[model samples]
Target: MACLVRSLCDSQPVARFQRRCGLFPAGGAAGEQYVVKNYFYYYLFTISAAMGQEVFYITFLPFTYWNINPYVARRLIIMWSIVMYIGQVSKDLLKWPRPCSPPVVKLEKRTTAEYGMPSTHAMAATAISFTFVAVTVNQYKYPLELGLMGAFLFSTLVGLSRIYTGMHTLLDVIVGSLISALLTALVYPTWDLIDHLMLNSPLCPAFCIVVPLLLCYNYPKLNHYSPTRADTTTILGAGAGATIGFWINNRYISDALAEAATHHVLSVSGEMLLTMLAKFLVGIGVLVITRQIIKNLALKSLCSWYKVSINDHKALQQFRIEVPYKFITYSSIGLNSTVLVPLLHKLLGLN
Candidate 1:
């Protein structure tokens, strides 16, 4: 087990695996002194990275399913998508290089090929932990002191991990944490107002869809290379999906599910557990299939319409075809998670 952990912690093996997963650049400059060779730091940063992963957040969905109140789930999904979009945009606009091997420490799992300013990992950790604690304290009447303590500890570890691994400068982590805190403070109070407007306004869908696309279109031009196009498309697609799904849920699903829950007696723990398991299985399957189909179709259609060959990597990147493709795919995922998945639950008599 120790050997396996060491092997997995090795930079070359982990980096190669990440590259094959299409999550990192194929090659990057390497250096000896700057690399985090200490096994202890390697494991720590690896765990830290996993904590900040999108998949970890997705696990909260099942809890929402069990509770029958998706308020927290929806908020988390929307907040994460927006935060990532903002972080990626800022990184691209700044176009700052990450801590390279010669001058600074380089860590393993350096998958993202984007600029390093205001570390997204730090931002995401702070945003998620802070938002979760805030919601729990405000809505659920949980103890504020305990929530704040836990959140502070988690966010601190995540921020420290970035610096320890040499993935970001101290300033980057500080800025990232501050940005997340500021955004949370501003958005939390206004979310209800925004949610009302989005649900009621006819222009909600159009606004949500168009605004993100416009943001992508107007992204700052940078001479140096960055994953600007890919990152923009990912968030835009997710934002669009979440927007459409939220609208659909407000129109069709939320009230019905609430009514059904009130009408029916709560199930026993065993039954509830089984239902949750089934819901997760079904929901994940549908989401995976929907994402794959939409991504393929969107890419093919966009390539043909732009009169660019799919194989022309340079043209695709230059024209930002990834924007539309990711938009369609993530939108489907968002829609599936909110609208279709609940409807399926109802059909299956799980809710």
Candidate 2:
């Protein structure tokens, strides 16, 4: 079955197009090699690809939530979750292969094994960058053209990075970008209504938690395993946790405390810069500790219930174990980013 799948993938027209675009010599004789034309692009696109990665998301989202504005942070996460979930699920449904490697030099090897029909990197970059522009235009005073230009640059870099890294074809990048833009457009009109419900309505928290969990559990399956489902769960879980945290802050927290979450400044002096740097360090430290503790606890507890060794990586990847543990760990991280971090700021006199 695997051989048949591989044969079809190699023979597919889309795959052939990608191979031709790569410009690498296919079926070369022994000792023949492909050389990079420019080291500058190799480094630049590598950095751009990092923007769509876990490390970037983990750092960027919390900075936005803790320092920039919680309202903006929540909207970015919501948009990201929608764009990424659809992209990931679509990859499984379509079951497209990455560009064939003999003709395509895969610079980033980690994700080469995953399906790459619609590039999630492109989707995420488009959604987050454009959504940031759309959601914050009214609240903050910035030139609209500058904001739009920034979004375009961001999306273009990420899209180009996917092709340069040989993880996705041009078709993948284009379609992924268009899909995210469409989703953002459809979702933008409801931002105010969603924001209102998330802050004030009692049903918001429950909806946030239940809907994501259900989606994770019912995630599409494949004969071959992929990280898409687990990654999607992590995203949805964090978004859910963040939403609940915002709701709690709006409901139970005092007026003064809630005000802290809403306030922002356009400029930062040297002193303020020092303070934000401190907050970023401290808040990230607290979040890391919180995540590790919860993750270990969740893993051990789940393993115990399932009668599997916590050290067994395979067992941990099972749907029952993977979904709950990742969901629990990231949700806690998300919750703390919105709720506890702000409280910490007050106690430490950083705010």
Candidate 3:
């Protein structure tokens, strides 16, 4: 099983990087790719792959915000936005392709058609895990070694899972992890400063809103269509929403312990555990309802405004339509997660 997985993952297609450097052979084929037939490893790897995906992110970030610490969540989302944007743009600029089918069977198809280098899965996994550790290392009374170990394990699992799913080569995984590490190192010094500015600076909201939208609008174009741009918009929109929401929570909502919330660890015991569970359930319910309603309303409104049929798939993909709808829908979810849901918790005695 190990050798089969290895053979499959190690096989590389001659993408732009390989073509220029003459690193990998150009003769690989989709038919020659090896598939994971064992049930145990297949399920394990599939679950690992999910860790770096959209569903995991949507749930994970909000869970941190509502249950853990908003200060940590805020920084995590910001780092995620930065790392993912750079990773996505790099993939398009580098123009790499996934491993060929014959030697590396791709179990997933949704992202297979997209360029694959410095895998975003690896980038996100590294960023989220290490960023969490970085933010909490000094704030909480936890074992630094334990936190580092957990981060490493989480990052390694997700990175290796990319290869197991045949979505990335070893090189892609390595580069992705390295890039995220470099980014985190570069940004960690300014974390305290950034946090201060975000929570206290009156101008932070406008900066957050304008910068991400501009990044989304000016995202690099690909020769052929890819989900990269739309995905980037979703990420940026969520980040912007979360940032502004943080600002609102601090500046106007003025919860007394708002700034001091990150000073300690959240203890989970009997009734506390139950309350946390309830909070997650109720909070997530509100978020889901918000997402569905806003997504539908935004899509329909944009479609109407553009005089495009709501059912027109290609028309909906147009820059004006897609960007606004995705941006609006996710931004609403982000805001609701950080601001509205917490207020609801306080009102409902979930706090």
Best by lDDT: 2
Per-residue alpha-carbon lDDT of candidate 2 for residues 1-351, written as tens digits (9 for 90 to 100): 987545434424433433444434334442134454555666778899999998888889889877777778878988998999999999988988887665566666567557987899999999999989876777787888999999999999988887766678777888899999999999999987888888899898889889999999999888866888889999999889888988888899754444333333377699988988999999899889998999999999999999999999889989999999999999999889888988998899987
* Sliding window of 10 residues with minimal summed lDDT for model 1: 257-266
Model 1 misplacement above 4 A: 1-29, 32-41, 57-68, 103-105, 108-112, 257-270
lDDT of 3 by residue, 1-351 (tens): 998546434555313222232222234465433333355666766899999988898899998888777878978998999999999999998987788765455667778658888799999999999999988998898999999999999999888777767678887888899999999999989988988898889898889878888888888887667888899899988888888888888888956425545476656689988888888998889889998999999988888888989899888877888888889988988888888888888888987
Off by over 4 Å in 2: 1-37, 256-265
- Candidate 1, residue 245: lDDT: 70
- Model 3 residue 56 distance off true place after TM-score fit, in angstroms: 0.9
Instruction: Score residue 81 of candidate 1 by CA lDDT.
Output: 69
Q: What is the TM-score of each candidate against the true structure?
A: 0.79, 0.88, 0.89
Cα deviation of 320, candidate 1, in Å: 4.0
RMSD of every candidate to native, in Å, equals 8.1, 4.9, 5.9
| Cα displacement (Å) at residue 85, model 3 | 0.6
TM-score of 1: 0.79
